[model samples]
Target chain A: MIGEFSPGLILILGALLVPLLRGRLRAIYMLALPVAAFAHLTTLPHGDLGIIELSGVSLTTLRVDKLSLLFSYVFLVAALICVIYSLHLRDTVQHVAALIYAGSAMGAIFAGDLVTLFIYWEAIAIASVFLIWASRTEDSYRSGMRYLIIQVGSGVLLLAGVLIHYRQTGSLAFGALGLDTPGGLLIFLAFGIKSAFPVLHAWLPDAYPRGTPTGTVFLSAFTTKVAIYALARSFAGTDILIPIGTVMAAFPIFYAVIENDLRRVLAYSLNNQLGFMVVGIGLGTDLALNGAVAHAFADILFKGLLFMSMGAVLFRVGTIKGSELGGLYKSMPWTTGFCIVGAASISAFPLFSGFVTKSMIMTAAMEEGYFWIWIVLLFASAGVFHHAGIKIPYFAFFAHDSGKRCQEAPLNMLVAMAVAAALCIGIGSFPDFFYTLLPFETGYRPYTLDHVVAQVQLLFLSALAFTLLMRTGIYPPELRSVNIDAEWFYRRAGRSLADGARMAAENGWKSVTHGIGRTISVVIAYVQRHHGPEGLLARPWPAGTMALWTTLMLGACLILFYL
Target chain B: MSAHRDPKEKRYWLDDPANVTRLVRVFYVVCAALIAIDVFVPKHGPFAIEHWFGFYGFFGFLACVALVLIAKQLRKVLMRPEDYYDR
Candidate 1:
């Protein structure tokens, strides 16, 4: 049945023809791929498709449960919006790679078997690095190399886990595999790496900001969310995620506050947002799972919107560094307005998407008696508002005039941002309409008066703190500097280690060459001493001496032979 | 050029110093209103600290202040030249 066919394949196959067509046709064709795929998603039947035997083992190719379907809906929507955002590009490699990346991510989410998931998992890694490399700069090329290694490393872990898991259980099903086994733990770590769990996260802020303007939009939507879906499927309700989620939510915000690149700030914010979802998965209640999924849904849009706005800024102004930009509201008023909408959505303002969804997870943590975790989440909530909610738009568009004036973002980019911004407001305003799509039926209402009051107070107070800090010159000023994170070990310390090794190797090589030269010269001198004109053998009596020595040696050998 | 303004130069209401002050003043009023409402409203949570009057507001404020201050100290160690990696 067509229902069993993977919708992700639509873009994967369709991307092949993108380079063949001319400009307008190519745009229309690329845009049609996702729309067609989304249309196909609605036609899919819920439940596992027929298992096909692959050399004595059965593999589930398509599983269309609410969970997978929910991820697909957002993935396709994001793909459509990202394709629209990148329509201004002439880079065919980027165009093709973005679609394939998005498609493979979608494929990974819908994968029903561990082997199938691994295939799509590695595909996502290989395909997505091009988005970063699409920037075609030396920095981007290097960043993409590191990104590829981490992403492919995640896949390698997944493959090893899958092999071990299949050997142990004799099942390739991609369902909940608890961390009781080493294979399950390996799989969790794989997902954790992609999820940007603390130390595993450097790739996100390192590579994302370097992606080409439109490519970042595509980059932001797919890869980590695929990992989130995998975790939601296999590792939901794991207690460790509670603590991991807190670190994910909290530590990144500190980086966000000090980050100079606006997009990298958004990347840190992305990590913080993922932390919230991770916590939701940890809670494992119906409400919490719904919150996790809903928040993922909302995040794809709001985060994508944020990336798009910054991308437009980078596209026009040639920089996303907060220290180098301000008063851009004058030239790009529409972008500034859209960016504020995105900011409000991420900040979880009362009428924005973050409020309706993220609060569900917080309420779950509260209900489940995760008091310390809840406190950390609350602090993360306020801090996210401080950096992402306020600092992004404030610095990029309002803080101080950098005296840059240019045309507003391309119409295509504005349209894409506007669409994402609308969804953010739309989801926030009519959350019930959006919640109907949740995988589980949770009888939770987001707009209770008490919930509203608590959230408003928290957000407003955080804003007040920001105002006071700005007024008192207490907030750290955005500067032209880099703040080292865990990745610094590799970028700095690791390179230093490598450089030390290289220098040692060079010295070692130099000494060996000197020793070899000395030995060769010594051998030559020894030989020359015997054979040169000044040597005894080279003297005029050398012939008589040679005859006597030969006769003596011959007589000695003859006497020994006789004996 | 006219004494009042140059037509070529663009400006907005936010450019005026008075308007920024007004925005801040209004923001303070809204925050104060939020606190006042928190006093009258019933707040519930899993923990006792959550129910404390003005707890969310005060906690958020203090937490943000601490986050910024600690981050400033961290900057001493973490901050490097923009070209630090490139170098």
Candidate 2:
């Protein structure tokens, strides 16, 4: 009986009850839902449930497998953290949106068929946009619209791919669809867009920063991670993902470094981390696949931790701009500490979650004879440590004082951050507990002597370089500026194209009206000349003209008769 | 000046310029020591280039420096006022 129930349905249906409750009841209800779903997930055995046949097509609503279970476990954990973080808020809409978004992500992961996956895919898009809109800023509104369009566009492509695939293969199962077919290609692009692949990545950094403090935390955990799961499920072992992922991993660090907004920098860093998972999926070995999933699991915890810390700063100080924030560790020591933990975890320092997970992919690359790709990944690793580890903490906490005093984050926010930070450390210190949950069994050890020494040298020397650059003033100062990325083509070039079209339309209308006016005037002149009282037809000799016209007609008739 | 005096009296240890300078010096010494230890430790790098003394340290340092320099130039092309999009 317990196996028949869907964990995602618990959260989705549980969301409907949110508006009915008030005060502490609503808070308790919200917190219990994620826990309930998590418990439900633990009890269910790995098998399919809720299978339905519709018009000769089968839809699998609940499919319990190791991969789905792995993603669902992390999704629920993230939801619990987000719910606790947002407990102080009275925004019923955000609460509902967060639940539905989390539920839909779970639903997507558990979906057995492409049809079921498509439903949850679109559900995630519709539900998550509300978080951005919760900010109620005009900028957030616009950014939310842009996020919606891109997300929904991804959904449409997924639907298209699914339908084409169903027609072509006569089955709707969600599994490996290599690049040999159009449907598979469409599905890959859809996942690519959501995964924040280079050109299609702008919406993430653009919209994530615009969400409310707590809302951004929820937003960070689900969407792109879900896409990573989808990619791992369908496109594992695709060779193209290597270069695609390499580009994804490498390019964002440059943007992250020069970016002023701390939250936006985290967003870029998120994309960079996703690139590692994508590369792992490309490598397609048992170790690499496990690395991909394990990294995804760890990423949700640590990235959410990073976002939570920045959200706290934004909550207290009303800005996360690196230029405007400094020496905040004075006032918000706990939040600062948590932020550093997050930074260290993300930078893959020794004994951190990232070190254990990210290295597997690197090792896989090297073992598979991908010498150059491994080199790029290594360079990216150093670069990530540089921006996320050093830049975030240095600018926000340790640089010259900005003289802005603010209280530490609210109690609920701090508690939530502590929970996430604990998990980050817990996973880093005892990765075996996490490794057991991965999709495959492995004997990979992250703490080999060489890995430890090399990692330390990479990180410590990067820190040294940062110190030297800062002292020499060679490092670029954080300015109150936006560093343009791929979004520029759409936000700028696309807008310009729209403006040109509008101008052309306006000019075309003017010319059209002018031509119509000239033609109308010509017709009016002809009418006036012919129909006016003093015109030739109205002259006093009209009778004589009629007689001549009749005579000419009769002569023509006579000539016709003679012929 | 009176307002400044009270805040200055409440300054944390980390807020002191002397403390910060000392910490930075200590960090530099630690970095130098780590690099120096590379010479004494047994080389176990998988790649031949990695066996070079201080290779990781130099690579990390040069990578960071290059990233900063390249990013600085990128800023010249990509940086705009924060309200660039809003306008």
The local distance difference test score of each candidate is 0.91, 0.90
DockQ of candidate 1 (2 decimals): 0.58
* Residue pair clashes in candidate 1: none
Per-residue lDDT tens digits for candidate 2, residues A153-208, read 99999999988887898878888887888989999999999999999999999999
Q: Which ten residues in a row have the lowest lDDT in candidate 2 chain A?
A: A1-10
What DockQ class does candidate 2 belong to?
Answer: medium
DockQ of 2: 0.60
Return the interface RMSD of model 1: 2.6
**Tens-digit lDDT track for model 1 on A1-563?**
53477888888988888889988999999999998998888877788874677899888878989899889989988998898898999999999999999989888888899998999999999999999998999999999999999999999999999999988999889999899998999999999999899999999999999999998888889999998899899988999999999999999999888889999999999999999999999899999999998999999999999999999999999999999999899999999999999999998988899999998999999899988899999999999999998999999999877877889999999999999999999999998878889999988888888788888888889888888999999899999999999999899899999999999999999999999999999998998898887876666766787899999999999999999
Question: What are the RMSD figures for all models against the true structure?
Answer: 3.8, 4.5
Could you tell me the TM-score of candidate 2?
Answer: 0.92
Which stretches of model 1 miss by more than 4 angstroms?
A: A1-3, A513-563, B1-7
Tens-digit lDDT string for candidate 2 (B30-58): 88888888777776545777788888778
